[model samples]
Target: MSGIFKKIESLVEKGKEAHAKTWHNWAGNIVLEPELIFHPKSLNDLQEIVKKAKKHGKKIRCVSEGHSWSTLSVTKDYLVIVRDMHQIQVEKSEKYGWTITAEAGATIKQMDDKLRQHKPPLSFDSMTVLSSVRASGIVATGSHGAKCAGASISDQVVKLQIVTGDGELHVFSDENDPKEMSAARINLGLLGIMYKITWHVQPLFKLRMIDFQPPIKSWLYPATLKEFVEKSDSVEVFYWPFNESELDRNDDKLWVKQWLRTDDPITTSQAELGMERVCEDLETRFGDKLYQFIVKCPESTPYITNLLWKAGPVSKPQNVVIPAPDAIHYQSGIDNILCDDLEFTFKADKDFANVAEEFNHIVDSVYAYAKKGKFPMNLAAEMRILKASPSLLASGYDEDPNAIYCFIEVLAIRHTSGFEEFSAELATRWMKKYKARPHWAKAWEHVPGIKPYLREILGKRLETFESVRVKYDADKIFFDNKSLEEVFYGSPKSTFTESHL
Candidate 1:
């Protein structure tokens, strides 16, 4: 009825390939040419587009930045892009801490910068997929911070405003009318378009980071991971792969310990110079060609440290406060390099041996695949721990208070080179053996029987999620894409069923 809706309709009817090709994901993995891409500027504009699509019976799906490694955001129908809705409003609260409200399109960097302006600034410890934060809301998949005691970005949500499939807007929060806040926290774009989210902030605190290299097996076993967390405010491990010969064993891993403390001003000039020195040494020893090759792979891969070990080990300790937001999320050098390329996450039980066994299984599988000419060398896996949340489809699922998040990263290469099949197989085997749940934003598909598998394992929780979906989305207008449907409901045709069978 509105002029904007009419213009959107004209664009969809045109069905131009040029329009379709313009949409690309962060890793450049999925290139979708949607029939219509809606760039709505306001909540009203979004509602009109959705209403028209529902009325016209056009299959539609919403996409953020396509930062997800999976094909979840890809669709041939109408693809909603939420980039223009970047508005942030900060308010001081007397009872609770500060509350910051932001549109879905605002980047994590933007949120962090804005929050810093207030006294006793609050920190959100979650890492974000590069370029992916622009097109989606912050709470969609419950993005997490790295601190063991820290909560995911979703947990910080105090309020949310979502536009339902039928173009009805709903507001929910703890203080206001509560309607399944857990389920709403990580809705996977299946519930509705989240227009705005408000986060409760903590007082600003400085984090002291101590970086040390230790043998992963000895220093970062299951027990060690728990102990490290208990000892420090936050702990993260980075395992580097050995050279091409011994990819199974990690040469050295970087362990960073961050603790809350008063500001102790220190100059970063020395740390920056050290990093530069290390980089220069690497360049000299490995040569530019090999150094470039190493930079292409994810930092979690065991191969990275192998090259470093071959060159030489750091003689002295390194200490520095993360200067910028990106510095904290993106580690220096190889860690930062690989993040721009690929990302994946899996949820597993909190058993260290179980986790270690799975890592070994994947490593062994990579070796076996390499022998058969099916493995790719340009990838890495990061291991992180998270506490379970009440969200239905959350990776942590049902478990003890805490769970582990293993993020696997691989370099993005041309699909024709068999990397796609290799990655798929890797994901399949991991899920099959470990019963791992893939990250919503990362690359993965719900194979056949996964729904049933989840139903069996998760039991009533799965049923509750389905019931909520049925109540909220009867016609499935919100779930226009296959991936969303598969994740929330069931997949009619699943590769898991045939492959597993």
Candidate 2:
């Protein structure tokens, strides 16, 4: 046991911290102190530790930036911190095009910066979490944007090198095997520790942005869905809470924005100011009065931006072009704003009407609670579109190759005080009513019936995933956490007990 610690110490002599406090999650809600925290410098070092941990029957949890809104990364046993596994190497391929191999620990921003060095460059549509923190190889779940044509980062992965629970290294790709490819893409950190990933990249391009605010009454309802589908490359709607009577009569507004591939040069100053101005307008329109009232306002920027649309006639679109990486998405000023959870999707099939009804039910229910003073002070719903991909776990499941993604975010101002309770209840309702599944990385728990719902919705794909899991993780080496067990194995209680190495 002491030898295991010594080996880890040798690899990460400086970053290691003993008796360290359990890390806080991205939402700042849950924290757990692992028995030991090890940062392995190389894949070999990781394999060494995995070998020892398996021999001694120790449970392991691999952590990245700890940006998950859920407890998936929490562990009380052996925790592998892979922040030092950062490396970016690109190679040109004549057959499959450009292949970029990166260590899982590299941040998305770092990868984007490196890709820009190419002649034509390469780019990803969105980023997960903040760029400063080291991102885990898993892409840290639930980090997606509103590009219907784009897939989650995991979907871009072409190959991966993972260390199985027994410390055996397996290089998986589509050409070598299909089972390995499916499981490796979503791995859920359950197969083993992912060491390296290779992804397919497109030559760099610019993204054009046009921001508009439109009245909620004019846009979000069933009537506008068709027009929304045809008019934009990517469209998102955000709603705010104000006097319901006033809003119903045309007071509340919606912010709509679109992004398309373009040939324009990047606009750094305009992008920054656009975000700041959006924030400022939100603060100005709502004022501190709403915040003090503890009223859950629609995220100020989106709502205010929407109001701006109603203030004038819709005209020629305003255009702003920036580097694809920089222009991909914006962090609405709620940096401190924490969500109980978020769920969005890429597929809206026959289930669209049913899902829409369920969504409206939840919204109406929340509003009813607010009217009764039973609602928390912060919460908002957002809707967006996405194009489907091959990744099994991707939200854009198989409705259409290109489908709209809708997001409903329940933000919590105070962690305690009914916010958590309400959000949990709402999640359960969503699962029961819409057969909805929560994002793996967001704030959601595996309720009793969730697995069956997933199986029913995902059909044979779910069975295929299980078959793949059985092949890669016959012993369940990566099933160390309760949440993960619930997600993969449908266990109401975890069977694997924690053992120290």
The estimated TM-scores of all candidates read 0.78, 0.79
- Which pairs of residues have clashing backbones in candidate 2? 121-204, 148-386, 148-387, 240-298, 254-306, 296-377, 346-395, 346-396, 384-405, 385-405
Give per-residue CA lDDT, model 1, range 117-229, as digits (tens): 66666655444423236414446765665665554567767777888767888776766534466667777777778788877766555556676776655665566655665
TM-score, model 1 to reference: 0.78
Candidate 2 lDDT by residue in tens digits, 132-160:
44545345353556665565667667788
**Candidate 2 C-alpha error for residue 294, in Å:** 3.6
The lDDT, on a scale of 0 to 1, for candidate 1 is 0.58
Candidate 2 Cα deviation (angstroms), residue 450: 3.5
Candidate 1 regions with alpha-carbon error over 4 angstroms: 1-21, 125-132, 135-138, 176-179, 243-263, 266-317, 322-327, 332-351, 360-375, 399-434, 446-452, 455-459, 487-501
